[model samples]
Target: MIKAKSRPFLKHGKPERRPDLMNLTDSRIIGVYGAQWRGYLQYYLLAHNVWQLNRLQWVMLTSMLKTLAGKHRSTVSKMARTYQATTDTRHGPRVCFQTSVERAGRPPLVTRFGGIPLKRQKKAVLDDRPPAPMAGRRHSSELLARLHCGRCELCEQRADVHVHHISKLADLAASGQPQPQWTQLMVRKRRKTLIVCPTCHDHIHHQQPANTPT
Candidate 1:
């Protein structure tokens, strides 16, 4: 059933010679295979028939190899031999195919296929979330990654960077009240939150006092 469902990614009686991927780089080709296979396994982690994915594994491995072979104008056996590598997992070292891309200022992205253990994972988290707004989720991820560059937006302080947030943009420019320097900065940047270091954050809070109970 899985094979039938995946027929579009395969060729008739020639799943090992995918000409469709001839234009992609080896890293992209290999990464796509790894991500798809991992996602499928994660989704079916609780199924009793989880071991059945080994069959899909062979199917995808062949297609990934053949796709690379087509790109390099080489034979499947040669491509397999070239990219074959051993990766260590909780289940021990497993043979897989790998591809890499080195960047000038960052670590290389090393992608692999077929190192995952085909074992039952009763406690694995399933990737079965219902669709919802992705904007907030994406914003959090971007913000977390931004923390590594820990430079405050105010005072140019590199230590103790933090954020100052307003509930809404309207709060930053309440009807007749004069905008504070912090509010002016947030308005200039057109953001509801301001990134600051420890000292600047204290100053901002001192100026923007909390409202008293009515």
Candidate 2:
């Protein structure tokens, strides 16, 4: 079973230190092994400075070397923690490695079952639909004709309020549910009722008992 080591504690048991040199050096040795296997050690050593690399950079370099050698490469994360001891830091550097091989000629085009060719599909035309009217939806306009916001129980800012419904219009329409008449009655009866915002409306529904009778 794999186990995570506790990071070394600094003053007040805080762990904040760079990775040790042994880990970085091991990664370099693995990188050299990969380079030798790839038959490009001389070229790699001449072109790149492997000795000056950090843990993350070393992992990336080693992974690249393995790829060039046509061998299965270790994951960057695994390479980063290869020589990690119990006193090593947990929050080490993250590395991702990628490689590309040159293709000499055109590759075969094979289609899988149920796959559509890209060129056969037509581009969608713009709908050009007019914007929906918001005259009755405005908070000030809805409150000017109504008495309550229908969400919060507090009575303040009636003019700057909105008429909120307990059930959403889409949900009611989809499920064929009847609109609650108490919402309408509350709006008409109280002249200075609660004026809740959208956030409060959502919060009330979220916090309310889920199984309570509508």
Candidate 3:
């Protein structure tokens, strides 16, 4: 009334404010949505054996999703719950995860520190003693005495000049052939010839054709 000079036909003033009532409901939806999506992603990666991403990668991805959604706490809790549920079902009872030795009744056969078995030590001690000085022709003494280092007649080697049988005794016995007196003569006469380096002995046996006459 008092000269309200008709407010000069004001065009657009500030629009009226409207509160977003959907925010609360939208937060829950986002929580559930994030949980399902992240769970599926984790499961798929595990199934296909893709282990390239570390924990930090996963955290970064979830953090980004939560920031974009604008409801970080709710989404993280939902994702955690989903992860727990999936792990429990897919991986079996957590308590069952254990080392192989724990499952077996005996102590681990191997140890971090190298330790020889008692049986092996006993065998080694026995081996150190001379081979009962095999009687006749002083074969053991002759082997210990003569036989200077030289290239093996069969396989060339100057080291490890140990005794080697040209034909295995076991193989001869198994062949069902009667041992002739000449065979014994040959064994006794060739005692000097029997000695060769370990490498040469192995090579001689390896080169022999399997079906050759004994």
**Tens digit of per-residue lDDT, candidate 1, span 14-100:** 566555444434666787677777777778777888888887888888888887877666888999999999999998999988976
Model 2 scores what on Cα lDDT?
0.31
**Candidate number with the higher TM-score (2 or 3):** 3
Determine which window of 10 residues in candidate 3 has minimal summed lDDT: 111-120
Clashing residue pairs, backbone N/CA/C < 3 A, model 2:
none
Q: Is 1 or 2 the stronger prediction by TM-score?
A: 1
Question: Estimated TM-score per prediction?
Answer: 0.57, 0.16, 0.21
Residue-level lDDT of model 2, residues 74-187, one tens digit each, is 444463344332321234432322222222354432211111111211332334344333122244544442332222333332233444443432333343334343333333
Q: For each candidate, how many residue pairs have backbone atoms clashing (under 3 Å)?
A: 0, 0, 0
lDDT of 3 by residue, 8-106 (tens): 111133111111111222222333333432333344342333233233233433432343234323454454343332113233433111111111345
RMSD values for the candidates in order, in angstroms, are: 14.5, 25.9, 36.5
Candidate 3: misplaced stretches above 4 Å? 1-136, 147-157, 165-170, 173-193, 205-214
Candidate 1 vs candidate 2: which has greater lDDT?
1
